[model samples]
Every structure is written in C-alpha cells, then in structure tokens.
Target: MLLDEASIRRESEHVEDHIKRWMTVEGHFRILTALSTQMTQDAISVAKTSPLVSELYGRLLTGSALLQLAQSPIDRVQCSLDHSGTAGTLLADVWPGPCVRGRVEHAQSTQAPLYGGDGNIHVSRQPARGGELYQSVSPMHASSVAGALQHFTMESEQVITFISLATVVDDDGQVTMSGGLFVQALPGMTDEDLSKIKGCLAQAEFEDLVVAGDHPFDASAAIFNDVDWIETGTDPILYRCRCSKQAAVGAVRTLSSDELAAVRAGATETVTCEFCGTDYIVSAVDLDAS
Candidate 1:
C-alpha cells in the first residue's frame, strides 16, 4: 500500500505527538519514529500516573502511533496491555488520526511490572467506514512494552521486524523524552540487506538519539548513512479524548425506558470518561427528550 502524504496526521494545532515515516529507496524495509515530548507527558497525565507507570504508558502511545502504518489513515488501530498484574489493564486506544486516547483501569495500581509478568499485547483494527474487525495477540514476555508490541507485529505478520522504544523520566518524574522505532523487512529485500540495516541501527545509541538536538527523523540519516532512504511523510499524534455531554446522554439512552425514567427523576446523572476522567453532567432535560 502506498503511504499517501494526504494521510499525514495534520491540519491540526495539536502537533506535539507526531511521527515521521519512511522506507528504503529499494523498498526493502519500512521505518517509523520520532522524539516525542509533550504528547507523552500530556497523554500519561490523563491517568495521573506514577513514574513507573509513565514509561510503559509512553511506550504504548509511541508504539501505537508508529504501528498505524500497517493500515490506512482512515482505519483504526487499538493497542491494549491485557494483564492481571499490579497495574491492572492499560489501553492505548488510538492512532495518529482523529482521536488518540488512553485509559488506565486503576490509576493507583498502574505501577505494576510491565505486562504484569504473564500478560499479552492485544491489537485490534477495523475499517473507518465500518467492517469486520481484525485482531491479534502476542505474548508480552519481553523486557519492555516496545518489545511486546514488536513481538505482536512480527508474530502477526510472520516477517522480520525490529522495534525499539525509549522513555526517559527526570528526577521529578516528568517525561523527558519518549520515542519508538519500527523497522519491518519488506518483500524482495535480501537477507544481507536486512542484516545491514539492522547492524547500522543496532550501532546507533537509540536512547541518546531520542533526545538529540535534531529531530529523530532528521537525525536518523546518521544511522542509515550507508543506505538510501525515502520519506513517506510526517504526521502529528495528539492525546484527544472523545467525550462530551451528548455522548453521555447517548450512553444513558442505552438503558431501558424504565431505567431511563428512574435516572431522569434524579434530575442529573454524572458521566465520567474512563479514558480521561472527565465528567459530564446529564440533565433530566437531556434524558426526558425523545
């Protein structure tokens, strides 16, 4: 599939969460990355997470955005950490498109070990126009959230792939730098070619590059110096929660008519978004209508 420039997550001021996508000139591989900042801080803040939880949250956000390349811009991809660990279940339910939101089942318990020790990375995708859902799961036994995501993609695609994720937090527990790298071997690429690309990337100090002066995309040239590269385009990834009073009312409408009447008699009901913890008040007028 062609990586159309029009699909770049742009035309918005919320450009803090952004990524750059590229492919080898010989079409041997696909790569995506960025040294993200505000987006990470803003996104993890949605859950008021602890330092331990922040790093994993950052990786999920970055991994999810980079993974969007596997589908069209109009499609949707959701990544969730399904585990019974101390952190409970964490979800990065978004792409670089319209809404990039996340949820923490238990904010206070989000400090559990990555993947809760026996969890799996669950991925789901569907057409924006509405169609059958495509889902996949891979064991999350790796050392990092990035590893788990990479494991899922490689196993799901049954292809050679490389993924690296970095999250740096300061003494104050602030997200200093957040980023991810995804490299997938495309058809026709020789084993030697893939080896060369991997070698060059392996030698590059990924964590350092993530905080280097230049944008990770521009700085990537130093790592791929021996190989020619082509740019598909760049797009922003912002943390945007899709919630509102109207949505709350619609949710309330899902109840039985009798239940709705009982709720309306209360005059108002509070709807708190599990994703962002934003509260919306549903008035009797809203429930009484229609």
Candidate 2:
C-alpha cells in the first residue's frame, strides 16, 4: 500500500466532509466512514506502517468532530477514546477552522488481548482562543471503532449518519490510500431525496476508492440529489499544532529570573506540540533575558 501524491490529491478532493462543511448542510447531510482492513490469523492488519486500527480511530474522531461542529457552531472539538481494551486510549482533535491533529498512546504492540470488552468514547469542545470545555461519553458495542461511533451518534446525538473508511497499506509500510465518507439524514427531508443519497453512496467505487487513494472525491451530485445542497468548499484538514517558542519564552518570563536560569542550566525546558510533533527547546540564552 504505497501512498501516492496524485492519489491523495484526488481523495482530498471530496470523499469526506469536515465539521465546518457538515454544519453548512445541517439539515440534509449525514456522515459515513468505513475501512478496508483484512484479517490475518483472526488479527486485523493495516498493511501499512501506522496500524489500520489507528486510522479507524482517526476516522471516528473525524466523524465526532463533524457532529460536534454541528452542535457547537462556535467552538472546535476533539474526540478521544480510552479503549484500554487493546492499546491505551486514542485521541483526535479538529477545529472549526477545520484544523486536525491526533495520535495514539501506544501504537507499537501487535495486539492487546480482550476476549470481549467494551470501551468508552469521549467528545470534547474547547473554545477558539480558550475557555471551558464540554465533554460527552458513550459505551462501545462493536469491535470496530467506527461502528461504536455510529452507535454513539444515534443514541446520544439522535443524528443518523453513515461512515465508510478504508485503509490499504502495503507490506512496505506505505499507506497506499486511506479515506472515508460521512452522510447524514436531514430533518424534513423527503424519501426520494434520501434514496438518491443512498444511490450515490452505493455507486461509489469502493474498491478503486481505497486502492485509488482519492481523498476529495466528488459528492456534489450524488449525496445531495434533489435536496438543496451546497459545497462547503475545501477546508483542508491536516496534522498540525498550536505551540510556539515565543509562548514558551513568555511563560519563562512569568517565573523569577533565578528560576529561568535554573531551567536553562539544566537545558530541561522543553515544550512539545502533541498535534504536529513539533518540539520547542528553551536554551540558556533564551532564559538570560528573564
């Protein structure tokens, strides 16, 4: 599963809709995410470097982000799952600005034995700059995180969404293609329109979709049907961070100069951004001003 730039560009064009976009179609759209994981000896394998499990976790987060965006229009959200059943918990965050960042706690182990266990999924919303965050949790029923998320949406949010996510990584550890779709039923929507939505979802080239590795696949005509729908445009989603060295310096400034000196001398002042894997280091000179 070797991921290619062209294929990614194609997929990035329209296969999935983000939170901001989902909000625009509040009354008519639904979310859908699925994956193409093949099992070996009863254990699922992603065929890529980053386990398929991690990708599924991400899709779930993406769906949660969209759902949260619809409910809390002003704030950005982050969804996390503590499926300690397998690995440690999984975390994912997305902003209305449409920014996304996430990762796994322990992604190395091949498998974590859990004959049959349930897990928890949490959704949190934090303000634009900063403010009190809100959270909601639900129990997982299926082995697949996506399935559990769908259940959560239905039971908690009372929204009907369908997600289809797939990941095809090769033996070489390259993710040939990975993406999903989110389609929801709008209130007061007609059955004919709903049927059209289903038709589009069904017509999708699932096999070529994952193998083709198209990100932004077209959903304009397929999902919308006769219902009045609009393209929310591309709110490019990516792995990012909101940390800075200057911010770190400002924090050191709050401390006494002596404290700054100690931190610099130890060369122990480090700020790491969980979203983008960026590390900011505070050096002796940096603390001298303090």
Kindly list the per-residue Cα lDDT of model 1 for residues 144-235, writing each as its tens digit.
67778778878888888777777776757687667777788989999888889988877785556765633455457777778888888877
* Top candidate, metric lDDT: 1
Off by over 4 Å in 2: 1-27, 30-49, 68-74, 112-116, 190-232, 250-261, 264-268, 275-278, 288-290
Per the 3 Å backbone cut-off, how many clashing residue pairs does candidate 2 have?
33
The TM-score values for the models, in the order shown, are 0.85, 0.68
- Clashing residue pairs in all predictions, respectively, total 1, 33
Q: How close is candidate 1 to the true structure, as a TM-score?
A: 0.85
Give the CA lDDT, 0 to 100, for residue 266 in model 1.
79
Clashing pairs in 1: 17-237
Instruction: Report the Cα lDDT for residue 244, model 1.
Output: 81
lDDT of 1: 0.73
